[model samples]
Target: MNHFLALTRRGAIALAFALTLPLPAVAATKIQHLISPGGIEAWFVQDSTVPLIAMEYAFGGGATQDPPDKPGVGNMVASTIDEGSGDLDSKAFHERLDRRAIELSFSITRDYFRGSLRMLKDNKDEAFDLLHMALTSSHLASSDVERIRSQIMSGLRRDTTNPNALASRKFLELEFANHAYSRPASGTLESVPTITVADMRDYISRVIAKDTLKIAVVGDVDPATLGQLLDKTFGSLPAKAKLTPTPDVVATAPPQRAFVPLDVPQTTITFGAPGVMRHDPKFMAAYIDNHILGGGGLSSRLYHEVREKRGLAYSMFEALLWMDHSSLVVGNTGTRADRAGESIDAIDKEVRKFAQEGPTQQELDEAKSYLKGSQMLQLDTSSKLATAMLQYQLDKLPIDYLERRSGIIDAVTLDDARQMAKRLWGQGLVTVVVGREPQAAAEAARAPGAPPPPKAN
Candidate 1:
């Protein structure tokens, strides 16, 4: 037994030594710069080891800049582009894409419009041309436009009957009031019909201009050839883009509870209040604080008290949303009608305690470690990298944002987190329940001694 133990110790030491030994240097990743003959600037990263290429395009004017009474037009127009463009009808375009095994996708967010294409190296040239036509000369077919519009309206109509959807939509509407962010990504039924092909054409031309576009290409290709390809794809678009006056998103006052009783087993609850924007000064601190409170899953305070200890709800969580003018931290959970009262009370107690006492040293350390580790994992893929890059560019964040992210989270002391929670998260939390109605729950809500729910949407 002693001999075996001695051998095991020696093996452990050898393993440690091997692990500490210097690793061979990896090839440096090179970011290539290109200026097309037509003056469109782009970034490319050449990786010859892979026979695949990914390209991303971003337009400055996002959903927020849609023309008046055309709330959903920006997204609708962007969707219609690839439905049928240039010489290809929708079916032909899809057939060619299928034959080439190309992946093409488009999306419109509150802040930016985006398109992406991926193809095998052998099909790069034809795939590029197909996407180029879709971007530059999409006919915005009237029939296709009407069909997509109808779909959007149908979705909105359906949302009206969905409890979960209604709760969330109402939360945003109440929280943002008249703010553009309050509008659905897909416009309302009334808003969709007002959009026109001319409107779509004008918006597409202005928004997808060369100057306002940022392109990221990653694949196996020579830098010079990639530059030429970019020229062929986007160079003809005019250099100057028509800029829209981005509306100032003003904060609405705290909202009152407008609960809608439903005859369902589960009541979907939603509440919204101003939180913080992504660029807020205390953003990192708030992020760290939130993780310890309810954002950390099993490790969070809400999980421990509500589900683990009291068995009030199976799941509970809170999240923060930072819009242009305002932000919100919202949480949700569901429980049996009878236990709903106890669940809300337990959740509120934790929130109040989190606000008052803040996180302990252990909680802060665990949260920081989790966040830093997650940061490493998020950067492991090219798609995630491109997505992060797009967000940073759209938000005008610092170039070192990626590298300095860890330091920011590390710098957040428990006090810093607590202070931020007290300042930002303390603005009266909004309580939203999406489960069966409970008389006890309503009484708990009305109790003056009960902690004020975060600004109810």
Candidate 2:
């Protein structure tokens, strides 16, 4: 028997082209809702291929809720949640987690507190039960409280001497003066020492209201099962949704350049000011615009002009930090003691130019490409997708926010980016520089006998 095969060049080329075609769409994990009979709302996605399940729970109450005296209380409480919960002491809790191979952690930000858990789908029941207890029935043990408190206070004490840390703290205070956002998320030394257990409990109850609780789960669970799980976990918590009120944004003064003399060899410089909040319509436009200005890594104007071309600093750029009603655009860089001013001047020049003329067509195209590529990459894992979805939910964004996102960038022409830049750039940018030996240099200019130069602006 003989077998023969033959194909013309046209046929072979067609076959190759067919092989190169993209694969069929993997149905994007659809976001579904499961409302507990007790009124808790949860958003979930089902993907059966992975053997893991991840869940995140967030409360509106965050560091901003801390009493003015105990600034870091919220942060401490967030960290202590899983350290001990219900009947399990911290040691016992760790043992249980190790036995089950469960991953659980919590964190607090200026605006919200987050509890996250990841476990094998087969072990999800036990992992979730432990997590639920941690959230609703944390022991708030005195020992753990003091333990975390000590760590935070120690860090705060150290912050005063760390130029980078001091700069950030001072900048927040200056930019958000009179606004809770101005306060550091980690409470000050005074506040941390005074924060009591009662304060922690009250803060959690008030800030972690049902409405404030946004749940995001991604894994092999079905909608019905997820609903049951949510009910079992968070159902008994208070149904009342008492969210943290939005903080006010005071009119901050314009760019004030100040330098703090540190004992360090290098200088850290930071610039920019009040910026657009999460829900602003200009949010997307500003995001793309900043990408071109500095947020786009090596492709950004600040990086291209400041570091690559002029060799002024190793890193430079602007980033948006947003909370409930308060937000800011902060640019930062570190350079030689003498060259720090040069970096700041270069960054300021680029910022002003972008504010006035806007991004060129080429810049806009590059930003769009970089942003779209990032958007696609950020969804690489179920957990990341879930987290992203939860953020949109918390911000009251539409479920299709992801699908509509690329269009926002594409619709942003060069002029739109420029307009955003102009409106958001702060003329009263507070510049903070930390360095050693500059104390005597012409640039130092410290008032005689002042305690110490403040951190970078």
Against the reference, the lDDT scores of all candidates come to 0.68, 0.72
Q: List the residue pairs that clash in candidate 2.
A: 69-191, 70-191, 71-187, 72-187, 254-428, 255-427, 255-428, 255-429, 432-456, 432-457
Highest TM-score against the true fold, candidate: 2
What is candidate 1's lDDT per residue for 1-457, written digit by digit as tens?
0000001111123223322332211113545566766666766656654466667778777777787677887888767888767888988887787777677767776656777777778888988898888888787787888888887788888887777777776777776677677787678778888888888888787788776788777667777778788889887777777867666664454435656555444455454456667787788888888778887888899888988888766467777765444567776675654565566678767877887788889988989999988865664445445555655655567655666778888888878888987765455555555444567546555778866433211
Considering summed lDDT, which 10 consecutive residues are worst modelled in model 1?
Answer: 1-10
User: For every model in order, what is the number of clashing pairs?
Assistant: 11, 10
TM-scores for every predicted model: 0.83, 0.87
Q: What RMSD does each model have against the real structure? A: 11.4, 11.8
Candidate no. 1 TM-score: 0.83
List, residue by residue over 201-221, the lDDT tens digit for candidate 2: 888777766767888887777
Best by lDDT: 2
RMSD in Å for candidate 2, one decimal?
Answer: 11.8
